[model samples]
Target: MKIIILGAGQVGGTLAENLVGENNDITIVDKDPERLRELQDKYDLRVVNGYASHPRTLEEAGAGDADMLVAVTNSDETNMIACQVAFTLFNTPNRVARIRSPEYLRAKQRLFLSDAVPVDHLIAPEELVTSYIKRLIAYPGALQVVTFAEDKVSLVAVKAYYGGPLVGNALSTLREHMPHIDTRVAAIFRQGQPIRPKGTTVIEADDEVFFVAASGHIRDVMSELQRLEKPYKRIMIVGGGNIGAGLAKQLEIDYSVKLIERNLARAEYLSEKLQNTIVFCGDAADQELLSEENIEQVDVFIAVTNEDESNIMSAMLAKRMGAKKVMVLIQRGAYVDLVQGGNIDIAISPQQATISALLTHVRRGDIVSVSSLRRGAAEAIEAIAHGDSANSKVVGRAIGDIKLPPGTTIGAIVRGESVIIANDRTVIEQNDHVVMFLVDKKYVPDVERLFQPSPFFL
Candidate 1:
């Protein structure tokens, strides 16, 4: 696919890297020449340096022949205008714009009609991140939770900790542990290496485990791998920025939420805006402030400040101060890997989450959801299998009969209202939402091709 991307920031740059590897022609447009040069030095893609919303810049970025235009500049106005320009001038088939402001998105339903905005898809990173954090809070022990097939099925990642039922037992014992619920252990990562899960494979402590199950059965399955903590009640957020504020608004009703902001004026604004949350004014990393707030009693401490160092410092402090679970938002890839396994319970990359959401539209098959697992090294995809055996490579075939790429495993199938855990004899029918886990993401294109229906049907 020929794709044009606006902005050379984190989201756009990461998308370029991901799509270029999938054999797509990617062209990036940005105002920062240095950032453009950096991307040009690393990946095989075209880059145009100028105001992204300008028509000349879009034309230089090959918008005329582009199959898709992704507008993700920092400015929401620039992104929206770029999509409109691409639609009016170039007639790009697909236009995806990343809009951050809530006001713009709230008005999108009424404002974006026909060619007014011309945005085929609107992605909000802040909204996506807020939803991501909410899921973690809702499910006490899961490191990652992703829904698929209209929320009928879920793919979850967790750490196997000591004192859990299945932590020291073989994978086959899961059925013995939970006789009624059906679940499949899709993949396991032991000491940072991918281990193909089998019935006989043993789950050691600290092993990162991935599993698929019906949405209702997720909590039961998760309890087997880790000692589930009590549902979160006392929550403390270290930043009053967009994500922190959004999360507090969602969690305030169900939990005891407290928000801390460094700026006094910003804290006052947040206090005025929030109804149930307690707003504090101080540095998040300050010992006095945390101690006074009773940080030791915090069930979950989330640091979402823009500065990576501040977030790391505050999260570690919270953990040492007896916070049960500490999650920090880190944008840099290296920082995420460094702190995740240590004191921090979870390290979230907003860019990775954003890319996963964007890839749902970029994918060729009838994909319903795409989740980046293990920091983008692996992916969990839910795609609809269309057509009959003669017309589709996946439909009307047994699970073992399909030619899946290496490091790929069929986890489950959502057929109509039923959820089926995939086995060798499990047969796939037309229109089934097949959930597959790929340990190696380079095989994504191959998997997408396998789910495509015959050209005659199109």
Candidate 2:
């Protein structure tokens, strides 16, 4: 695939790195020469240094022969105008833009028409990050939660603790513990190393475990591997930025919500805007402010400030101050593993969330969804099997007979309204959605190839 990306910021840079690995002819356009040079020196891709929305810049980046155009520059106007220019001048088949403002998003239908701005897809990092946090709050104790087949099946990651039922036991004991619930252990991570799960594989303490089960059984399966947290009620957010404000808006009705902003004017604005949330004017890292607000009684403490260092420090302090669970919104990938392994319960990378959402459209075949797991080292993909037995490699074949890559597991299959846990003898059929887990992402291409229909169908 030939791809051109606008902006050298976090989202565009990360997307370029991911797409370059797939053997795509990637070109990134940005205003900063230093950023462009950094990307060009690191990856095997072209970089254009100029105003991203300019026609000359797009032409220099090979927009004429590009298969897709991704405009994710910092400015919403620039991103939208770049898409319109690509559609009108280059006629690029696909155009994806990153839009942040809610006001612009309200006119999505009007702006994205071919006769208008012509954006085929809009990636909202703040919206995606807010929803991701809400999912974690909804399902306590989960490090990450990804749904497949319209929420029929879920893949959840949890850290193993000493008190869990199956923490020190082999994977096979899960059935003995609860024979009624059908679930599959997708992958286990021990000290950052991927472990292919089997009946004999034992889950050790501190290991990150990923499992697939019916959406209703997600909490039940999580309790088997780690002590389940009580449903959160009191939620404290340490920023009034877009992500923090958006999350509070969604969770305030269900839970007692409080938002702390360092700026008094911003706090006043948030107070006026929020109906059920309590807005406070204070530094989130200040111990006196946290203590006065009864931080120890808060069930969940989330730090979503723009500064990574501030968010990390505030979250760690909250955890120490007796907040049940602490989540930090971090931008740098270097800080994700470092913070997640420590006091912070979850360290979310905004770029990773944006990249995963963008990948859903970039993936080939009939793939419906793709989620980056373990900080992009692993992935869970949901793909639909098309064509018949003669035209597809996966359809009408038992899972055991299919040529699946090593370290890849077919966790579940969703047929119409029913969700089925995968087994050795389970046979795939046309139009069935297959949810797969890839522990080793090096084999992602192989797994993708297996789901593609033969040339006869094409």
lDDT of each: 0.91, 0.91
Q: Which regions of candidate 1 are displaced past 4 Å?
A: 455-458
lDDT per residue as tens, model 2, 244-275: 88999999999999999999998999999999
- Which residue pairs overlap in candidate 2's backbone? none
Tens digit of per-residue lDDT, candidate 1, span 18-115: 89988899999988999999999999999888998889988888889899999998999999899888889888889999989988877988767654
Q: What's the TM-score of every candidate structure?
A: 0.97, 0.98
lDDT of 2: 0.91
